[model samples]
Target chain A: MKVVEIRPPYLIFLGSESRATYAKTGAGLAQWRPELCSGQLRLAADTVDLGLPDLTLEQAAEAGVGSLVIGTAAVGGGIPEDWYPVLREALSRGIDVVAGAHKRLAEVPGLSESAAAGGAQLVDVRVPPAELPVGTGKKRRGKRLLMVGTDCAVGKKYSALCLERDMRAAGMKADFRASGQTGIMIAGCGIPMDAVVSDFLSGAAEILSPDNDDDHWDVIEGQGGLFHPGYSSVSTGLLIGSQPDAFVVCHEAGRERISGWDDFPLPSIEDVIARTVELGVLVNPAIHCVGVCVNTSSLAEDERKSYLAQLEKRLVLPCVDPLIDGAEAIVRGLR
Target chain B: MKVVEIRPPYLIFLGSESRATYAKTGAGLAQWRPELCSGQLRLAADTVDLGLPDLTLEQAAEAGVGSLVIGTAAVGGGIPEDWYPVLREALSRGIDVVAGAHKRLAEVPGLSESAAAGGAQLVDVRVPPAELPVGTGKKRRGKRLLMVGTDCAVGKKYSALCLERDMRAAGMKADFRASGQTGIMIAGCGIPMDAVVSDFLSGAAEILSPDNDDDHWDVIEGQGGLFHPGYSSVSTGLLIGSQPDAFVVCHEAGRERISGWDDFPLPSIEDVIARTVELGVLVNPAIHCVGVCVNTSSLAEDERKSYLAQLEKRLVLPCVDPLIDGAEAIVRGLR
Candidate 1:
């Protein structure tokens, strides 16, 4: 007779058979009504205990069990110390054990070898690798982009989103990318697609790369935050791949913290601009221009102009507001 | 006569030199001195009343005061509202007002235009900018580098230091191009260079990339908290400039709010790898391999190896311990 198995933690306790399994195995302990299992149970004569028989596994073993089916329920894909002895005994008796899901278990010590030794094979829960998408032969060209900030929560994404929007609006292809912390978590599988890739494939976006044949410009990938470790790694990877053409940065001091940021050596407008420009030179030799967007809530327009003049004097490129001027300054500076 | 300026919170009462001017020209008080400002007596040719000064320009013409300097002791750039009228009257006379470091008087509405119209120049305490050694043109190709973190404290600098050590150990030319946060802050002028950059420049350590010849790698850029918006922006900026060949991503658990992270859907290891890989792809098309460095306080070698293998298979990359396998796996995967 055929046997159907369910992993533990879903309905029954892990490491043991269900009360329904006891009756199906013909164990003389107690009989289960078909109604108990919604009539989905299959009565099998040769169900066997494959591990340390918890009370339920023991009853099934005593009832002359033959085969064991395993799914993700067993140890959440981790190895449990109690499952070994029963596995060994069952293999010795010529019973087959089938397992699926729980890829991590493939690395559990001696488990794969033991199963293989017993002539059993493990199956993965992922769509057979064949179902995954293949690579498109593409390369990123020279659409240099940069994301920067003065402090945390100071419109970094606003700048990036603006850049993406303005670039597309200006008829230049562009995409926003995530770096730092979000990159790390997402990199591991927190979402359907990593945030960086998501931006690239978004409806209104066009990736900033060489392969997509467009004229005025291709893609202008914008970054999310500053100095995030995960983003740093992801961005480094992108630079190695895409190689953008210009660097755009955002600086803000709407709060009193601007001057008080004296703890940082480059605390003033002059200092921040200088260092960012230098870094830009080191990374993208192709950086044609640099754009700085400043937050102006704390100061008046004249002061803002003065501050802009001061910063502009220091920066090799023009500095402007994204909300006010859009991509015009960036495009002009590059030109 | 030279006048000594004191900081804010001091009361001012008008004196005899201003009573006639106030009656004749309807001009308000002229000069202000802190109550205890007897120390400035020697510097003044005559004494004037200190109070809320009537600020008609004709009063100054009639009083023959020539020029008057109203001192508001605002410190730390905090400008109070009451000072604007006094500042405006003085500006109308083409008087030069020395604003306290804290008072952002220029930020007041109409004050910017007032200062310009009144020919009144606003001055604040300032020190001359310092000069530092710049990068040379003959250093190395692709030597100019920039490094960024995935998130704060995720070991961007530590990794850079290790990479520097390894490069030196292998006899490859390398230098710590930038000091990460310190460098960024210094360039921004948030702090004193004497305390930060000057010390480093004065030390025996070589600084590069001011000119063209110093091909150097920058170490670490970007910023943010543990999750959400860490280094995404800064990393993108760095990538736009430097385009490093590979990336090493360090990962940790997502925010605790994510339920069942250790299991399926929520915090599965697979999600992390996928997200990171997504960002890695944008950074460098050549980046197919992401070295997953699991952060555990301590684990036996066998356990570590087992975990690495599981993550690799799950994430589809060659995972390894930086302390053990070094960059070997990353290099091989990239190749």
Candidate 2:
């Protein structure tokens, strides 16, 4: 496992992505850490933008961009052949190439030599740290809140980031722990839980959120859902490894099926909460659900408000779209 | 992930091991596939023996041994420096080196060159197959029975093998699906579930026990316990991927705590059954526990019978030592 440290002042690569949904990685970085991002680079004129200045390879290098981060994930996580020339040019200019794609940047033909020639590093964000220990199941000192989802891309990362912000604003000691590529690029470090060996899934999660201050709250970003047939193991491992004192169930407002797994239906917020607690207790005896965070971006304004209100009333927990309504209400429940 | 195929007529290498427990791999191979084993190789005179003819590298080569399989796992699964010379010697003799250790055999300095020079292959059994897909969670065609445990090293592998042998003897279509190194060696081919990436844990399990004939039973070997804080994720993933129609709880008699974790106590048979059903039902709605396999070797002869009888009465399920009493009773319950 490799611990990836991506250089900042990034040039976001959109790679001809027309839809904003597929370009969420670039959007997330632009939304969260605008200062670290120097500009955006797109392969096509009609591609989605992250509101950053458009820059060419030479322009990005001239502007002192330290790395070019692939912001859009392609289907199957492969690097498109068309994007190679730009990446090669960036590397030739001593700009580090950072990617979380399944195909490693260094594995691309001639990429390593090009990187060596320009004295630039090629960072693979998906690789985990080496020699991770198996989960001890020993209780850690810090207070931790993990964001669990009903399916993949159901606002777990967003909710966690929001909680960290609100918790800090509310005068609490907190740190947002990233668990995926986008979040890792935003926070500058994290273990890609999905890429870890099955035996060390929980172990890596334990390393991701090590013992901290007694009063500190580690808002750990979560991964796949417990009911997700394909990835439930990753979810279960992360949940157990995190051993969160409290967790928030993150769900999309209107989605009924698992993101890519159409054969399986999504587990309800209640189901997610119940199962998270049921399995979480194996590691943390006192684990409980703190709130619910729903992604209501697809819902109408009225429907979003009503849906959240109905959910809060039914579950007897704070429910909010962390992006829109803010996470103050959820943070209030943490106390 | 690499699908390892070890050639038979094995020379079991028990490297300076004094404890029979530490040399279980050799013991297992000798017990299950005695005809395939030509001889034993020990570094020390007093080391545990598998009752095979003790042979030197020259004698093993003369006896037509195809592989020198490392049959003892060290503290951290590393090949000891002292054993390197012997391994090199075996490779130099054109005997393939087969190891399931954490440190790859190819990574051992000068071993690859020796193997190549002698036209011998280096087999790393822990590496998984490449391009494994995420689990689809779709029910496959076949009846599968999984061996789950209350903790690590609790006879799950032994129980599964026993069931496979017993079920076959009873004129049932059954195949033992190996998930670990020793079992894989016995079965000839299997995915090392623990070595698979976290996201593909279930996928690998799916590949391990693919869709078979309706009457065929894939008795999948299980890994870590669901109650094991360090390895529950592997257990959960395997359970989901196997989608076993039936499961058998494999437990060691009087083992109160998790094998390596002194802090966490073992879950009871009832607890294991309940939770296995609870989690397993997500992938296998018809999942049920058929019987219990207890490793009662630690108990007295009279005590073992009485203990099993009392447990059978309480749990209302067939309870037997798969090794001592045979898995026939459990096989009867499976029908």
Candidate 3:
């Protein structure tokens, strides 16, 4: 029922360090509800080198893009030096700059002053929670929905955000509570849960959703998968903290193994649902899995259909590819 | 076989915060090998009122205590103000300082210069790993003995350290690998695994116990229980990173639940053994629990006798209260 207003179109800027590992972060902006922003992705290097189609910075400038989004994973180095000229150029043009990288562009020496002088917002998406409390075992009130996935980078945030938007569009009072860098960037407010202290990971979730009546819903974004070797703790913390009343098991069609982990085979969708429900019940025993949110974008049309059909057959719960079918089914299933 | 020559007798300093939650940490040094330190606990405050027996700083000074040990957990506040005067007094005396608190005593205002002037060593127990690598699932060299536990604070480090000592006493090349803050303090090296990034938690463990030949054994300390809601991630990361050839299941005699979680009931000893073995196999399938290290300190003599007898009878593996029987049976069992 509410749409952001007075915000300018975002011109996504992907520098040399933006591809391969971080390509999804850059592509997510234009791909997530394209009409929400001006359709332009500006590249620092030759446009032809990009795996995906994108425009050069000059082309974005020619189109008079209103905002700059640093849409790349920093891969630990945080804000590559090659990115400064384009970032300063964007700030000097009076364009608001938003970034999901661990490094804050605003901290690039004179960039904050440049942003201040140009009257632009300098946003760092992974800013940790200002104040987070240790999780109390006390039960909280809310119709909370969580999106868990079979692997990392499987669009749990996308599904959660989609559900939030659809619920809002249907005249329901709902909010999207982000749990990671990408989700934080999109929501404009959320803690990068992984970067938080080990004890505060779940506490971040509890603070984000808090408590609300059944009539009000909280669409909570999920983190890494439970089977992920490197980042499973973040997932476990989110699962313990959110205590969702119901959850969506998110997965990509035809994915055989956990991404980046060749040893971890993807669990059956049913197993994923069972594990999620089991974790939820630790806090709220009445909790359950309401639906399946499959990302079938990578599969061929026949492959997608067959894969979804197999998943639907296996799971008694309603299963839908949120990207293609929208999350209306999931929103309805939460009831 | 190797007693460190440079380190001198530690005069254990327990601030007012010592007795309540971090009583274990204060007591750890006193108890690790009581004879390793002088029988002196310096009180920061009043004449008596300490939850334990102790000596005054002047008395310790008269005895020529060589170093001061901050024998208390900071509980995240680091060094408390009330304890600073006593700390300054210790530093002024040219006493080498050792601590396991998250806060580094060396960095406390004027303390580093005081230490420098006094020609004393300022040691921070949990001073992170020097460099860490992502777990490559590569085969590593060494006979790793990991001490897993049924719950947190149930003596994983105690057993690991005990095994290390017992192995060395038996004329073997053994090294203790610390995982948590307290363990790091005891061993004088190793990462504070909980403070590590989620992706790097396991990686920290891998780096701490690098490749070594069969002549050497690594007795790695464990952290959090897998069933603990607040800290399971830390436990899981340690388990994966250690990839032990064999493990020892540690537990208190009367603990029936997870430490901070009232809802989480403790699994039976059999279940704990099975789960530890299962997780160990995830890293190296041939891995298993070689013995049990029970902390029967809370039990009466008759109860301890019957409980351990029942455990040893039910499970074929050797089960010993390491403090009582000295972990020699467990060390032999690792073979």
User: Best-fitting candidate, measured by TM-score?
Assistant: 2
Weakest 10 consecutive residues, lDDT, candidate 2 chain A? A1-10
Where is the poorest 10-residue window by lDDT in model 1 chain B? B24-33
State the number of backbone clashes in model 2: 3
Off by over 4 Å in 1: A1-139, A164-210, A214-242, A254-283, B1-335
Distance from true location, Cα of B48 in model 3, Å = 11
- TM agreement with the true structure for every prediction: 0.27, 0.90, 0.78
Best by the DockQ measure:
2
| lDDT tens digits by residue: candidate 1, A93-178 | 33344333334435545656666676643322221111212112132343546555544445554555566666767667555443
Q: What total of clashing residue pairs does each candidate reach?
A: 119, 3, 0
Show where candidate 2 strays beyond 4 Å: A1-3, A14-22, A41-49, A53-66, A74-95, A109-120, B1-3, B14-22, B41-49, B53-66, B74-76, B80-95, B109-120
How good is the docking of model 2, by CAPRI class? high
Which ranges in model 3 have alpha carbons more than 4 Å from their true place? A1-69, A72-97, A105-107, A112-122, A168-173, A277-280, B1-69, B72-97, B112-122, B169-173, B313-317
Native contact fraction (fnat) of model 1: 0.02
Candidate 1 residue B146 Cα shift, in angstroms, is: 18
Worst 10 residues of 2 chain B by lDDT: B1-10
Scored against the true structure, residue B96 in model 1 reaches a CA lDDT of 45
| Pairwise TM-score winner, candidates 1 and 2 | 2
Report the C-alpha lDDT of model 1 over B14-37, residue by residue, as the tens digit: 222323332211111121112222
